[model samples]
Target: MTFQWDAIWGALPVLLEGAKLTLWISILGLLGGVVIGLVAGFARAYGGFFSNRLALVFIELIRGTPIMVQVMFIYFALPLMVPVRIDPFGAAVVTIMINSGAYIAEITRGAVLSINRGFREAGLALGLSGRDTLRYVIAPLAFRRMIPALGNQWIVSIKDTSLFIVIGVAELTRQGQEVIAGNFRAMEVWTAVAVIYLIITLALSYTLRRIEGRLKIL
Candidate 1:
């Protein structure tokens, strides 16, 4: 069968809208993931026994599960157990935050631990309190090391947004499915959808590369 150029052209607007929502939710979710990762990472790295154990359980539980199951549980199961009912969009964002946070926490822990112990000791000797030393000395250096792993997680989280089609979030994959449903142009719609994802991920990779270069200089 001849490829349907017209179907792709016609579906561009809807696909772009879906792509926008994908990017939006990814950014929001990964931002929150970064915050969650930082706390969990530090707890695992430096906190006392209970805090470390708690963070370990959280990280392990999240990392052990599939994101689809997590989102499904949030959207469909949680309402049965609690006074909370998250809509599809909210569920998608929450799941990405949690799923990515687990991985990011591991990345953060590795980066922080890779730094020499002497730097930390030196900071303490210079009259910096433990909190101040962590903030002013350790965090900046570890963050530099985190750039690549964090970039990877960001890209993974963005692609993971497509899975939200299972929950009907109208993200890029769902838009492609809808377009194909209306026009019976699965080949064209799916090709357009894939190219859009490639464009976004490639652009993200390029931007992260530039940022990594600049950070290396500092």
Candidate 2:
């Protein structure tokens, strides 16, 4: 079939709206994930027994399950069990937060642990409190190491927004499918959709690389 530029032009607006929704959910989700990951990561890396165990359970459980299942459980099953219902957008954002946070927690823990213990000791010897040492000395170094892994997770989470189509969040892929349904131009519409996703990921990667360059520790 000849590619239809007309179909591409017609679908661009709808697809861009979908892309905006996709970015909205991903940004909100990832921001929450960063908060969760930092707390959980610090717990796993340095907390006492109970806190470490709790963080470990959370990280392991979320990482073990598929994100699609997580989304379905939030949007479908949770309503059955609880007295509340969640919309598709809420479910999508929550699932991304939980799923991405698990991986990010591990990334955080590893980065923190990888730093030399002598740095912490030196900070303490310089009369810094443990909390201040962590905040000032350890965090800076660890965050530099975390940049690449965190970037990968962010990119993956953005692409994974496509799976929300199962519950009908109207993200980019779902919008593309809808456009194709109306015009019967799957080839053109899907090509445009893929290009949009590629562009988003590439832009994210470039931004991350620039941040990494500015923060290079060594």
Alpha carbon lDDT of residue 56, candidate 2? Answer: 98
Which 10 successive residues of model 1 have the least lDDT summed?
A: 209-218
Instruction: Encode model 1's per-residue lDDT on 79-187: one tens digit a residue.
Output: 9999988989999999989998888888889989998999899999999999999999999999998998999998999999998999899999999999899999999
What is the C-alpha RMSD, rounded to one decimal, of candidate 1? 1.1
| TM match of model 1 to true structure | 0.98
Each prediction's Cα lDDT score? 0.93, 0.95
| TM-scores, all models, native as reference | 0.98, 0.98
Q: Global lDDT for candidate 2? A: 0.95
Q: What is the lDDT of residue 66 in candidate 1?
A: 88
Q: After superposition, how far is residue 173 of candidate 1 from its true place, in Å?
A: 0.4
Query: What's every prediction's RMSD, in angstroms?
Result: 1.1, 0.9
